[model samples]
Target: MRHRAIQILFCLSVLATFAAAQTVVEGSVRDTSGNPVSGAELSLHHTPGNTVQSTHSAANGTFRFSGTEAGTYTLTAAAPGFFSSVHNFVLRPREPLALTIELQRQERVSEQVEVHATYQTIDPEKTGSSYTFTREDLERLPDPLLESSNDLVTNLMPGASDSHDNFLAIRGTEFSLHEFINGVSFLDNAQPQFNPGVSPQIFETVDLMTGGFTPEYGNRFGGVLDITTRSGADLGGHGDVNFRGATLDNYDINADYGGQAGALGYYLFVDGFTSGRYLDPPEPRELYDFGKGARAAAQLDWKWGSKDAVKLLLMGGGTSFQQPNITDDQLVGRDAQRHLRQETGILTWLHTFSSETLLATSVYARDGSDRVLPTTDPITPYSFASRAPFTLGVKSDLSRYWHGHFFKAGMDLVRLRELESFFFDSRGDPDVFPAFSGGLKGGQASFYVQDHFSPLPNLTADLGARYDYFDFIDTAVQLSPRVGLAYHIKKTKSVIHAAYNRYFSPPPIEYSLLASFIGHNAVDPSQRVGDVRAYTQNYFEAGWAQELRPQISLELNAYLHTGHNSFENHEISISRIFVPINFHTARSNGAELVLNLKQWDRLGITGRFQYAVARTYFYGPITGGFAGDEPLAAGERIIPAFDQTHTGTAQ
Candidate 1:
């Protein structure tokens, strides 16, 4: 009887151990249309232990995991051409759990779906403030192709307004915003005064980041406009042509073609427009404002095997316009013509080492030239100026997911060359402007690393650092650190976020070099041309977002920026050539409220409101070009002329 009892106890212990290790998790992947999806990558993450196990679905779209420990886990499924799906659940000992993951087809191109997924999931993890216009939102515009991209920004984005000559100002900061097309910077494309007016037809999405961005973004202080061009993936073949004629002798023509063959895809877009009222005129009756321009852009994508892909982009555009004239100038028969040209080429390669790791590298070149013809009015003849700027750069980024943490690192190296000329034709009068010509060569290097992770179930944190080196007329180096935090209150359906960021922005290349040249030449004895330095700032932000209903959401955010060497621009004595200037100290504070109502019964609405104040004290000694003699009064706070205290928009 004793032997039997011992045997029974041992058997019972063995059975219990076996049962604890028998936890089975199984899942099937399917599309929204109820069709099975094979070869989908799936990952199972143990929340408490921070362990991850990955697998792929079989031919029948079924996957299984045995011997999983009982705990809280997150399961994620990702596949090509589909939106990723995530599921969270608790596993119990000796219990078999079955799950069905339904993925939604991505309507747009598939080239950057993985990259897009990272951003789509950022709302819960990001502490920054941003606004996005998706393809669907853009399609709703009555004339997407006809409307200027700047108009969309000024009309819809809070704290954004049009500055002098179609330039954009955010939070009273002029010439501080940066523009990117398909992840490539276009900073040197054309002079700062001209807007390329890229056709909206080629845009897949537009994202505007106002403040509190990560270290991956640098060299800009006010804002960043990130645009993703459209692709032809999954589209067999399609084309569109549009033409419109309106009053004021204005007309526009746009055409686009896209298709996919085998593993390669291509998209092409071309547009031309002529407008009688291109530039805002000083008088009610527009005169000498006629303008015409043409643009062409193409994208090619190729994918091979399962781990590698390549993309090529080419773009070129040219614009010729008559500078608008004031009533007095019109009466004097004064007319000026401006011509602008820009071209860009980029090649990018992507490789995926595993389900949790991705790498991307790109090599790009951009060239731009701007010329303002000399006016022959004789009475108020203006000098002619031209600038040709070229840029070549290489950028690489690596992304990895490990142990519930998302990590990213990247580096950028850029070479810059600029050529500039000015012809005044003073006609032997020294009082008139003298002719001058010069060029500059420089380079910049930047590196950054960041990690995003959840320390608790409801709290997420992002920590990063950046290093930058600039070698131009002067050498400057900076190291910046960034931190962000987000906390979710599930019961209240709200999220509270905060961020602290240090920013370093180098001066604009063309303007900085021009300032150096002017100082060396010293056309005027009284002109005090000081050295231009990189701008530095400390930014702080806090925000709260709440979901009122399934389709309704609201967000309120406040930000403060304290910086030195704030950037400003001044026109060169009515010549329309802008030069960079700076302030000794600058401070900006603002609050914004945004309300979004998703498509409910086919009706969607978005509303935004902002209140801001921007002030600067003491003009920097580095005033350049036309502003060489700007007064430098110490400790005098001056409100920026472009500051708009209150702005509201609804759509």
Candidate 2:
């Protein structure tokens, strides 16, 4: 029955991709001097429908509108220091219209224009620190498609660092981050150990929030990565292809195409690559680490009517890499290999009751699996592990803006099933190494409500709460509260913000079940593990931002987190399979400084520095795997393995 449901969903997604027709409008915004005008606001008013659509010009001054009804329309473009431009045109059904609008400089600005410019420069509604990278920003990076996205984050984001085993650690927190693609959880289905690969070109925008998040987001304490995929809307049949080659026989080929036909729009991307060196090796010279992988993604949008729209996104990929072995281990011919596969699909419906009110609902499914081929070497003997996780979920969000307040509410429900197996040939050392296999079925539900409001012209506040419930090997429930505030000082061109959030993160179901099994049935009494518990945290942050000039800005922020049952992962021996462990208490504090210089005519600079301290105390016997018996002495504070005291980056 489950398989049938999935099949039906897939079929619908494919069928919906071909069903609609509408008009498209695309253009670029430029100044009188022939320079591109970035961040220009545009509005299109339809005469027949008496409706309006609004958008902002991209960094390259491009803008597009898709799925519009054939009618007479008036288009207006406005910027902070330019005179607004207006154009009137008639559109035909199933046809695309293009234009280039130019804006003229204005000597004096009105009070209203000054207010608009201030709002554009500093977002008063933002209560926390965040960084956003557009598609153009990523394209500037060298070999973006050839490297993992983690490299981008660690290099560009302040307080972000690379942890051991290809994991990302933010603000001294490791293995506790959440990744979401188009409002669906990706990390939950694909564990970090598998190192799922995604091309940067697939993303339209990547927003990383380091602190001051609202209650609407849950399940992670380190940070939140919100990603929006590319779409065909407003792109009038545009495409690109690229090929890259380097030393060591490494090569990559990638392409993307997007366009709109009538009411239907589509975007497709595919990438294939092979490399002589994949995973980082312990030795200077990589050995037995050849890797290859291919991935493809598609997005379809159908605006069947003026008030309703449907979007479908599908992605699937697989990778295979040979695990490198040390020189001594190479003598025994250790040739372990790891293979990973993942597929995700999401269908969403959007309804617009009015310009100020909207509702979006989505149904998503995800499947991920990892297999590690055993290596039979004399010293290490044999090692093997397999994991498969399936997820199905439904989510909905309603947003309404009234007066000076914006209100949002959402709910998410998910069903999870996981199958995992591990085996290690102890070679007469069964006391420490054992084989195990297990499967689990579980469900999770969450509901959240938040409000962003301006009590004063320069002061904004965000208040919200959320409820989360989880059921797998055990049941856990939490009610968390969130609060944030931002105050802008017009005289100084500065903003001060602060936030407090309570977070709840449940342990992964498969890992928790495995820990339970090991604890109950251990070959040796001393090796018995204990039950894993959910992690909870209280996070606080405060920051200040100053606009030094029109093109330069500086920011400083500090954050602290106190957590219980802190989550951690550890690999078993030399095998790549990782297990979850918990500490009794965890504390982390950090501060970061950032400087940015933008729009200097083809030149940009960014610098960041961070200092942090992280410590965990009171180790647990339960769920610690082989370290079950190694408990910390009372009053002892030890830094986490992934902690870094100081980090700095300049780009």
Candidate 3:
């Protein structure tokens, strides 16, 4: 009886071992003629445990490492009368992977063998109109003067207007360009005031999503610019310094350093510039406008292991500009001066459990202050005194990915505080004008999820949705849904894509808070109105990309933007007070055509053409009562501000 009981216990232990979950690495060995190579020996070694699993390919050229644990591994395959080969692969829990190994007949037995690992592209699964430029492309620009700052954006993107300096208008929308550095956004109210920005040389790549963006992005309705800074990889150390000089007594200096030490890596970039008046002056003078600024950014990264990392990023900058308000080609003592200073920082932690699973978390903060002294009013003559429009904010985001699905959710909490002391009297009392002082504190929280799936050989689909809640002038909540599909033609290397997205954005805190000052401190009610909430837009896009030749390609895209709850500020009687209103139903339709040519014997060319028509129908107290117009004659439909019919660029 004792012997029989021991036998039963041993049998149970054997069955349990086989029933447990295990990692399986399976593959086949083939010859140059695609014939199965039998009697092939394979060895797999786990990196962490240092354990080895061996197998032999069957006559059908099939082999597998079954019942093995999950870990990083090295696999070596050897067959008689063939060159030995090695491959490195990883296995995650409950995930099985397959591979194919091709072996060539050996001319001579050698000890040296080069092992190559498979790599994949980081392109987003979603389909949209997107363009990417790497460091190599930026360095190859024909003009050195256009290599710094955000100049490349205007030069390359269709529907981008360069009529104004350092400003871009995309798809008929002005003041709606949102910028993100390493997945963290720089918020803008009504204008692009995020100043003292980084130099382009400090970035590794710049990605622009023109339209039909996914739910992972928010806070902007027009476009998205995603900038990725350079990183110090496993390479020991590297750095570069660049300097340029141009006409009009303009000069710039840029320097950067990157290196890796043990488990830590670091990168730093510094830029400075000084320029004599470059823009054509409204009126000729000794000096019309000149400015200078300096910016610096640094990052430190620590690698906990092959799959986990932590990074710290810090940046700060300041700018000062002087403009002599000239009249009749003569200097005026009432010169205008403006100063801006900004600082930003972020800390991030990232971990990868397998090839298909990842988690990332980041916390960030920003502080900026703007001081403007406009030309003194001829009447008040007291410099029209007002000062210090300061901004500060803190935010955080969490990202997770599993298989082919991605998710991101975060909150952007901000505080906008300002002192409106612009009033000044002829008596020069400095406080003669009623002073209005206050601040606006609010934030937005959002959640989004996206999935990428391939249901057919040449077709892909992506679906996502986002929900947002804003705590501001008027409490509001919104839900947006986005979807895209792409089809590839393998024979021609072409792609057809279509996308639809619903987008929502709230007015800037500074702009939304102005509603409170309507009747406060003797303020005139005729100058302002109230009621602010989030803006919503619907985007539809379709595009086709074709490779005409080995070095050339062409793309054409068409899009329509239909939106309501548009934010517009109206001046009742040309007074300083502007009432904010969501007064327009806006519609814009556009098409873009782009041609690209790769470097052929030292020269590359790119050209783009765009055509768009944007219109807005305003219905409110002000629009209905224009004196020169008959009531309901045109139903309040008119061309809004910054509407351009045709825009193009070439380089």
Give the range of the ten consecutive residues with the poorest summed lDDT in model 3. 623-632
Residue-level lDDT for 583 in candidate 3: 43
Per-residue lDDT of model 2, residues 1-651, tens digit only:
224335646765555321122335667899878799999999988643344588999898988765454445678889988877876554432223456688877766652332212112334346888766656556666784326567666776677766654566777666655666666664362233564656667876666678887766667767766666767664569898989999875888888899999889899999898888776665677777788988899998777666787777887778888887778768778888888887777786767666556676667887777898988566665788888878877777776666545677888888888788888775554325667888888888999998877788778898999999988666889999999999988789898999999988887454556666665666667655466667888989999988776646778888888877776666666776667676767788888887765334345553333343433333433334334445555445677677777787766
Among all windows of 10 consecutive residues in model 1, the one with the lowest summed lDDT is: 14-23
- Output the number of the lDDT-best candidate: 2
TM-score per candidate, chains pooled: 0.79, 0.82, 0.72
List the lowest-lDDT window of 10 residues for candidate 2: 111-120
Q: What are the root-mean-square deviations of the candidates from the true structure over C-alphas?
A: 15.8, 8.1, 12.9
Clashing pairs in model 2? 21-262, 21-263, 22-262, 22-263, 530-622, 530-623
Better of 1 and 3 by lDDT: 1
TM-score of candidate 3 to 2 decimals: 0.72
| TM-score (C-alpha) between model 1 and the true structure | 0.79
Query: CA lDDT of each candidate?
Result: 0.68, 0.70, 0.57
The list of candidate 1 runs beyond 4 A from truth reads 1-122, 144-146, 189-192, 281-285, 425-434, 520-526, 602-626
Per-residue accuracy of model 3 over 123-165 as CA lDDT, tens digit each: 2222678766655566677544344444666677666654323
Model 1: pairs clashing at backbone N, Cα or C within 3 Å:
none
